[model samples]
Target: MKSLNSDAFRMSIAWSRIFPHGRKEKGVSQAGVQFYHDLIDELLRNGIIPFVTVFHWDTPQALEDEYGGFLSERIVKDFREYAEFVFEEYGGKVKNWVTLNEPWVFAHAGYDVGKKAPGRCSSYVDKECPDGRSGYEAYLVSHNLLNAHAEAYEALKKCEKCIGSKVGIAHSPAWFEPHDFKDAADGASVDRALDFMMGWHLETTMKGDYPAIMKEIVGPRLPQFTQKQKEKLKNSADFVGINYYSSVFSNHVEKPDPSKPMFKQDSLITWEGKNVDDISIGSQPVTAALPVYARGFRKLLKHIKDKYNNPEIMIMENGYGEHFGNKDSVAVGTADHNRKYYLQRHLLAMHEAICIDKVNVTGYFVWSLLDNFEWQNGYKHRFGLYYIDFNDNLKRHEKESGKYYKEFLSQGVRPSAIKRDEL
Candidate 1:
């Protein structure tokens, strides 16, 4: 990363890695603790800021077996203990802390939709899932996750070594546009979609509760925060961390089937890559699930700025993913002009958000630095500036996108000097 003139690296610490079980009382791994110590020291030595995530959806199996993990309130106490342990251990070295990474994804995917680890969903939604309530479990898990974050934040405040540290949750919310701009309902769906997607967790940290729309729609399914929990949750984040990938067109669902209740249907909207006119959102990349729409990126920033009083923000993760089969050679992987274009356009959008809109964005980090084992996709999808040869002892090869980023950073161009159309 230093070679690419990158100054910061965002990484997550697995809860299982630190505590083999769930709690520190069970057993703490000295090797695991030392591993992070060495890694943090090396990053510091290279003058790179380390933004460490406390938890990244990896709940220790012991906790799951004991109390169903985040589905139960018991996990909150354990999470707080784990967070406190880390805060005391490396709090002095790591100033930027992410309490949780994409809690929305974790709860929705793992508990509601059953796409990721510890997959649990209603049998009707996914027969493969062992057992879970489609709409109910996600809300319960997210409720606990919010409380866990509040507890972690409180723990951080008490840690003397972490006095100067900044902590927040990394929220991955896709930008949404109305499928039919002419339809008022479609436009209303966009706001409802954002409320369900981003505001569920975000508004909790800001206002100490979920969006009022969610409370009314989800009703009994959505968990309510206690008066004490509300106080702890309000203003928990020092900064907002956003992991944006793509934007989608949101069409209003006139009436969802009451029989099949799920989190997605709860919002009464359907997300699409094409508008009502069948026009694509923007340019859809071959490997990307959603189309590239940089305009949505700027709009999303402005939305957050206007709604949240322009709090400090960080682009935690943004990049292009490509599907490369075994037959694809290194030459094809190295020539990633599409990825470069994606980066260029998004960066320009972010620049517009900062300069013209005056959004208080502090830093930006790409999705990845090297080809990694993406969860669920495994190694099939690569989203990295540097290509990895899994066949040849994991050899590293820099792609065109890497060169573009390196040059982009080396220039150190001021925002005022950038021409709007040049990018």
Candidate 2:
């Protein structure tokens, strides 16, 4: 990081690593606590600010077995206890903290789609899932997650060591545009899509309630917050953390079948990479899932600025991922021109948002500094600036993107001759 001129590093703490049973009363791992203390000290010694994430979807199996994890309300109290332990432990050292990272993805992907950890979904949604209500469990999990965040925020406030520290949740929201700009229904669907994806959690933290559109559509399945909980939740975040990667077109679904209900279908919209006229939103890189759409980053930032009273914002995670199977080689991975280009475009977009649009943007951290295991994909999808050679004693080779980032940071900006579209 010092070689690259990087000033800040964002990392997450594994809940299971600290307390094996997800409760401090069970047992605390002194080794795990010391490990982070050393890490924070090392970063500070190297002139790097540490932005620590309290929870990043690593729920302890003990809690999962006891109360089905985030699915049950009981996890909220456990989460509060666990978070308090962390705040009390590292509060004096780490100032920037993220209470939760992408709660929406944890709830929707794990419970509704059943593709992530502790996979649970209705048999109709995914027959492999152990047991879950497709549309129902996601909302319930999100409710508990939100409540947990509020409780953690309250805990942070009370910690004497956490005086000048700041805390927030890192939200991963994709910017959505209408598939058909000419269609009024499609335009309306865009709002609903944003409301369901980002507003579900963002609005709750800002205003202490779910989006009105969500309540109208999901109805009773969406849990309600008590008056005390609402007060605790309102303005809980010190800043808004965004994890932007790509954008998609939202096509309006005139009539979603009520018989087959799921969280994805609740918004009555379908996502498309291309519009109705067969125009791609942006360049689709080798990774099929994430399309390159830098403009979306600027638009999303402006939307947040205008909609949510212009809260301080931080780009928590944004990077390009490439898939390289057995054919991977140092030569091929090191010459990552596409990843470099992706970073350049997004950085330019962020610049425009901050300087021109006056978005209260503060910090921007890349998704990763080194190639590491990516959840379900393992080591197949690489999103790191430094290529990790798994076959050769875990050697690290700085890629073209890393070099470009170093140059960009050293110079503090790209050349004035370079235009936004030129990249």
Candidate 3:
């Protein structure tokens, strides 16, 4: 932690611990507050600035019961209240705040694909709502989530003592590569992937509205934003937090026309030869895991820089995970060499952003201080620079990557230091 320490460090409020019920009025655990109190004191003691994320996907199931979680329009006021509570409690010490972490995952993968918690499993195969909820419903939930984020931003504006503190939303924008470079249609498919992935939240933050395409696609099912609400969304974030991973390739696939809107107007397939309209697209071979594409990192930075008018960029999450599956292990094992390599390439790419692009790049946090519960994938994909033995009650052991990180930061990025084992 000391090696990478810059002028700023970001932290988050695990929503589940705070509002174990996911409702503002339901319950606020004193234990949870104390946990943060201890955490904040530690960070301050270390001279590390704490930037807090209010919700990081651990929403209390209670909120889901009350009004379908973010699906309900009521979530706006509720989330705003939660933000205010945190601000009042810790704003004197903790200033930088992020309203939510990765709304795209919350909406698309969590609710739509049903991969993570609060699962939704809908396939285009039957379209009978296998889970009894429409794609439109997930989108609606996301619509509510965006509004809730905006409200939280507005609430922080009133806190006078926390003047330097600011609130913003953290967005995970996935990038795509074109499956067939020769085909114009295929290239357009790649851009559309960015549209659905990052565009949803960026629209709310910068444009003061939801995606225009979502309105026509989701149609009446899409939620309405009041004019006053629109006005408030303007400049909702002082900065945009980005969590990016690997990039995928998009291919064209034709599909039948639907009453509700979807990604494909003409039905294009992703590179794997699956239909674009299939709800199983992500599961398709075309949607396979990305090998750390560093150039994609550069392109994504340029896109956000030129398109988003170069908002201050702080990488909220960017790291690799390896699955050798051996616990009680130590430094630079053969299994995690890829993760070490992934870190070097991505950091060089980040250097490109700061040096070449001049894109106002601020900070780079490598995913986590330690490996923790990675949702459904569980402990299978170890993203941490430090390895955690889950059987040991999540005991953290610094990997070669971790030591390399400390030295790399202490000395500076060096080619000889790029691969830690060799160093």
Candidate 4:
């Protein structure tokens, strides 16, 4: 953090560390709580503001074993209790808190695709995960997750230590454009994609219900909120944190056979990087990379402003990912020219949104500070400002992108510092 010259830092707490057995009755770890307090103190000592995420997809294994983790409504109360504990512990020091990080991704990837931890999906979706009902479980888990967030938000408001703290959910949403802007169905597909991906949570948080199109399409498969739960969910967040990396073109899809329901097919849309004419949306920087579409960042900001009542927004996670090859050396890896280019473009797009478009964006935090273990992709995917030498006692080395960010954060954008070829 001191090396990056970053003004703020964001970190997540592992629920298992705090409550090993996933409930207060099982026993709370004072050491775990103290560890965060010490870390927060060190950050403040170095003049870095701390933004803490109470939960970040790592539910306690004990919880998963107890009631199938987020699949059951019983997990909501457990999550609320855990969140309240954190609020009472660090709320006075940490004014900014994220109740949950990317619940949509968690629900979808874990239940729908069966790729993440405690993976579960219908046999038709992934034979390995034979326990889940793709569309049904995803919605059920999401419903529970939202209610848990509302409970946590209410708890934070009641906590005396958290008097002025602001709590929000971190949503990972990508911008979607029509594959053919002239095609009305494709344009409508964009809206449907957004509703399923983003509005599923944002609309519920803002309007106390799911999107109308979602209800109409998903029907009984989609979970419904009770009157009391709806009231609690409405205005449950102080702000919305969007974690954007790239955008894709959406094309309309015919409804799937009713007998075979999957969350991916429920939206009735397909995403692509290029249009039917084979024209790329933006430059592709890495292998298997989603095109680096910075314009989408600005477009997404304006969309949120116009559609979600212009709430205070924060760029929670935006960074470029690089695939490290076996032959790559530390010196070669640390140069990170591609990451520098990605950061430069996206930051510029964000500036345009804030200064030119007047999107009430409050802060921006890069996806990572260190090249840690990436879920599913594991260590193969690198998205860090500081390169981690995994083979050598996990030593940290600053990438060129880190240096660029240090300068950008300290001196603002210096066009002269960057070579034209870099962009």
Candidate 4 stretches greater than 4 Å from native? 1-6, 287-289, 414-423
Q: After superposition, how far is residue 236 of candidate 4 from its true place, in Å?
A: 0.7
**TM per candidate:** 0.96, 0.97, 0.86, 0.95
**Worst window of 10 by summed lDDT in candidate 3:** 279-288
Worst ten in a row by lDDT for model 1: 414-423
Comparing 2 and 4 on TM-score, the stronger one = 2
Tens digits of per-residue lDDT, candidate 1, 1-423, equal 321234888988888999999888889999999999999999999888899999998899999999899999999999999999999999999999999899999989998889998899999899999898899999999999999999999999999998899999999998888899999999989889999999999989999999999999999989888999999999999999999988899999998987888998999998887898999887876656457877888899999999989999998888888885655668988898988888888888888898899998888999889989888989878889999988899999999999988888777744445456644
Global Cα RMSD, each model = 2.0, 1.8, 4.8, 2.3
lDDT of 4 by residue, 92-178 (tens): 899999988988899999988899876888888888886888889899999999999999989999999889998898898889988
Order the numbered candidates by TM-score, best leading: 2, 1, 4, 3
Determine the C-alpha RMSD for candidate 2 after optimal superposition of all C-alphas: 1.8
- Candidate 2 residue-wise lDDT, 1-423, digit = tens: 221235888988899999988899899999999999999999899888889998999999999888789988999999999999999999988998999999889989898989888788999888899888899999999999999999999999999999999999999999998999999999988778988999999999999999999999999889999999999999999999999999999999888888878987999998898999999998976643379999899999999999999999988999988887766899898888888888888888887888899999888888778988987789888899999999999999999999998888776765343476644
Provide the clashing-pair count of each candidate structure: 0, 0, 8, 0
Candidate 1 vs candidate 4: the lDDT winner is: 1
Where model 2 places Cα greater than 4 Å from the true spot, the runs are: 1-6, 287-289, 415-417
Off by over 4 Å in 3: 1-9, 22-27, 123-132, 256-290, 325-335, 414-423
